[model samples]
Target: MVYAPIHESLPGPISPSDRIESIDALRGVALLGVLAINLVTEFRVSIFQHFLPAALPASSLDRAVETVLMLAVDMKAFALFSLLFGVGLAIQFEHLAANSRRALLLFRRLLVLLIFGLIHLCLIWNGDILTAYAIAGLVVLPFLFGPRWLLLAGAAAFLGLYLTMQVWSPPGLFPSLASIQSNVEEANRVYATGNFGEVLAFRLREIALILPLHIYVFPRTLGLFLLGAFVWRSGVLQKPNHVLLFTAGAGCVGLGAAMILLRAGNAMAGTSFGVLATPAGTILLALGYGAIIIAIASSARGNALLGWAAPLGRMAFTNYLAQSVIFGWIFYGYGLGLFGHLGAAEALAIGLVVYVAQVIFSGWWLGRHRYGPVEWLWRTLMYGTPQPLLRAGLNDSGQRAA
Candidate 1:
């Protein structure tokens, strides 16, 4: 879901110490969660629906695991990631004082994102989020300069809109097939026999529909963005001493999880109330996520676990792309041809394996390199200069010191 291009150079000071490990760690966690959900997508339907079935064995244990993942990661990651994007935007604007130049910078960034998104959609997969994000980010650009209250108000409206849209969304958004054999046969053709052009056409069609109907995602994103801004403005992210923050987060996690559990049985119905409840639950879950990060940052201060997650967060874009590549290989006809073969439980197992590998790989790679491979490329493109890619131990550029 990473979009936008790097400017030849971003103006203003890029501070070394401005980094916050807590936020980075939380981002790392969110990235893994996103992967968990995406794994299911790659293994299941062309659209985000329940139209497909698991090719793997379906045991009660597996079903329970699938249910949990659907609850925790499916709706949660987008909210968390969107909030982070908003926070990042606020930070970026603060770095460069509001001006036509800043607007130009953001526009260029969006353009780059659009280009990358198109590539991802056409070549990698049709169910790309970068394109949607680029569109939404552009939609809210004018409001970026608006007052905090206005931003919050915009977010509230979007949240309501998203809730309403969920009401109408199809169960699992996948078409119900008359038989498993027919569905699998069709999926095989798309994944195995179909060419990129056909995939693009199908994808673009979905994107067109999603744009108007998914307007709600923007408001939800905006609201989280405003919340992040408020936190940043209030110094909560940096300070980490707000007891109320922890309390609110705990309340959100506790209450939100319970509410989700309560409503989950109805999730497959595509009913109005289910959609509203899911987003509502997601908001509370996001609060809990933020609070936990703040609390951990406060206590850990400079612990090793946070340090480990920090590198993953720093190279999140690289990691996210890597995930798409890996999942495609695993589930697409190009690899094991496991598409539509794994059950939800099996998909979760595969997701866990992928997540573990990424954590280890990210930790090890960061130890020797200045940046994750893609991150280095992005930075070089953004700065229009070659950036150091390897650490020089002590007294080096310190980019890899994390």
Candidate 2:
């Protein structure tokens, strides 16, 4: 009897030519969801205090916008991003494992990513998720080759810690308005008028306060990575049977929506379960959204309609970092200083405009370049050799020239 590693036994990696470009499009969709939530939440206020009603707009339009964001996005967006990123990591490993010094290469890629994350968290925005993702990636490194059952079990065990925490209602783990009221007030004034040093200091303060929250969430993130890799090993993303996709999509939507609705009912009734209901609901809905996105993008008509986001997805890392830079300048004290100024509706509108610009720019840039600027940098560092960047390096078939 012979044993093969999970990746080797799986359907095997899809080649670039045979790649499902729609996955990139789906990533773009997830990115937009994240943008929508961030504009009204973190961009306007610190993630630490955004939960306070005093921190957000209170008008009817703002109310409506918040409702939509809460129901449709909020936690769902980042969940989807994590899942996609996990899949990307697994696929990359599959492609690299056959080559020389694969694990070392992955470590280099993650190290570079961690550096980028640290830069974003300290300099650009304190709400950065890249650092979390990079850390999660490091933890997930060995699990990429683990057995499929072990992957699922690891995800469950880690995620259960979060579920337990939410139900247990740990102090400081989940910030309350009372605890954050002063921080909110000080942050409002400081973030708007404070100098760069002042702003950095306040951000650092919040980082200390939020460290526990991050610690709690980190395990869930690591679990999601394993879940993503497990799903990738199943080969559903690249070579799906439509029936299975539809079944999973439909079931997930039904169950996830039910969980959310129950949570809402609990909120109305002032039950403790409402707050506890969010984590599982959001994760399930995100998974459902992923399945549906792949299903839609798999179709001919859906491809044409949704293809605009493909470039943005292809350049996800570049666009994500660029968004932090653009929005940070727009809202932070060092730039336009619009913190706590924009209404929720206006903030979301601005976010949409930025997203549109990204879509257009990504498409234009990819037409002439083989990789987005950051992707080029990442690959260059990963391989210790500068990878080709220009489309001119391509053969007539639009594939890279050997």
Best by lDDT: 2
The C-alpha RMSD in Å for every predicted model, in order, reads 6.0, 5.6
Clashing pairs in 2: none
Q: Report the C-alpha lDDT of model 1 over 11-110, residue by residue, as the tens digit.
A: 5324334567777788888887787777765445444335455343367876676677778767688788888877776776676674447877667666
Give lDDT per model, in order: 0.67, 0.80
Single out the weakest 10-residue window by summed lDDT for candidate 1. 393-402
Candidate 2 lDDT, 1-402, residue by residue in tens: 232233333222233354568788889999999888877888887665555655336689999998878987888888888888888888888878776777887887788999989998888788888888888899899888778888898889888887877767566565556667877788888888888899888888887666666787887788788888889888787786667787898788788888888887675245556665778888888988888888888888889989998889989999999988888888889889999888889888889999999999999998888778998887777767666678766542334444
Clashes of each: 8, 0
Cα error of candidate 1 at position 269, Å: 9.6
Q: What's the TM-score of every candidate structure?
A: 0.81, 0.90
Q: What is the lDDT of candidate 1?
A: 0.67
The list of candidate 1 runs beyond 4 A from truth reads 1-17, 48-57, 98-100, 166-185, 192-216, 265-275, 383-402
| Local distance difference test, candidate 2 | 0.80
